[model samples]
Target: MGTMVISGTVVLVVLGFGNHTWWLVAVAVLFLYMQYGRSGRVGRGASTSSPGGSGGGASGMTPGSYRAYRDRRDKQARWERRYRREHPMEARRQARERKS
Candidate 1:
């Protein structure tokens, strides 16, 4: 689903470039970003889980566990950003590895 959205966005961008209608590309990108946010694949602050799962509360995570999860996520993101900045080639290689 994500790949399809990305490919569609790329096609829209190409079409917009060819036709001089930049708004088409902008709208496609905006729609993709909104969908990404709604999908919960990149969340912040709290961890989401099934309601009936262990350690889950009404909001899907117990307060303490949620805090821990958020902390870990933040730490990892920070490290990733730093790594990417410091070792761009290595970061790209690792990303390719993970994708495969």
Candidate 2:
């Protein structure tokens, strides 16, 4: 499949240089396909698999991105917990204000 795309693009590019400038249009479209097509399956990190999901339905999240997102959220939660624990008075004041 990779070879086919490269070969077709090369042919279109070569033809585009000649009188058939219209071939370049097809080449441009093909280039876009290659760009978007390859972007989704870049590396293992950009896997098609759903992360932390069931054996069904796609989560539409790459494992690497999900891991990074989860790590960031967990770190923030831990920091917030520590801050609240140390500042019980402030935490209670904020909680009370939020309830009203």
Candidate 3:
């Protein structure tokens, strides 16, 4: 199933990386499998099982969704901060648009 596909993809990526001596691809796949696959499943399950899923189904906002939203917001904020440092005037224009 999903595991088979993941394994096959990992094998292909590793084989492709063999041309170079880069072990990072293997490490990256391992990390992605461990953190993303498990946590994503758990998050999806939790969100679907929560209350107020009246009609929104999987797209409904739950604790898991809020956590994801907050995480995205924080990441966006970090990027915006960096962008502002690089282009202060553009950032100011964006802020003005938001105000309008």
Candidate 4:
């Protein structure tokens, strides 16, 4: 894919020079930047998952990460409890349906 993009840019720049079309050259430069710039690097590097196959990046299972995850989970639980308190009939109906 990168090779094809580079080849296309080269062709575009050559055509731009041959035709004296500055916009073509500018477009070629833009394509090159899109193919090789920081955004492109990020897209390429995003798949570097840990060996654990969690697909959550390298620090996913660290102690600090676990603590953070636990804290987030607790906060979500508290929010859910508050929501249930605010909507007791909905919660009770859902719970009753689950029992059935």
**Residue pairs of candidate 1 with colliding backbone atoms:** none
The number of the candidate with the highest TM-score is 2
Clashing residue pairs in candidate 3 are none
The superposed Cα distance between candidate 1 and the true structure at residue 4, in angstroms, equals 1.7
Candidate order (TM-score): 2, 4, 1, 3
lDDT of 4 by residue, 1-100 (tens): 6566567677777777668685577685765677566344533434434344564644554433455477679999999999899999999999999999
Candidate 1 local lDDT, 36-76, one digit each (tens): 55555543444556434876334656444555577679999
Clashing pairs for predicted structure model 4, backbone only: none
lDDT tens digits by residue: candidate 2, 27-91: 77676766666665544445455575555333455656656588678999999999899999999
Backbone clash numbers for all candidates listed:
0, 0, 0, 0
- In model 2, the runs with Cα more than 4 Å from the true position are 1-64
Root-mean-square deviation (CA) per prediction: 14.8, 8.3, 10.2, 7.9
Best by lDDT: 2
Tens-place lDDT per residue, model 3, 1-100, is 4586477667767777655433556566666776557656533335544544464533455655665577679999999889999999998999999999
All candidates' TM-scores? Answer: 0.34, 0.38, 0.31, 0.37
lDDT (Cα, 0-100) at 24 in candidate 4: 70
* Stretches of candidate 3 exceeding 4 Å from the true structure: 1-64, 97-100
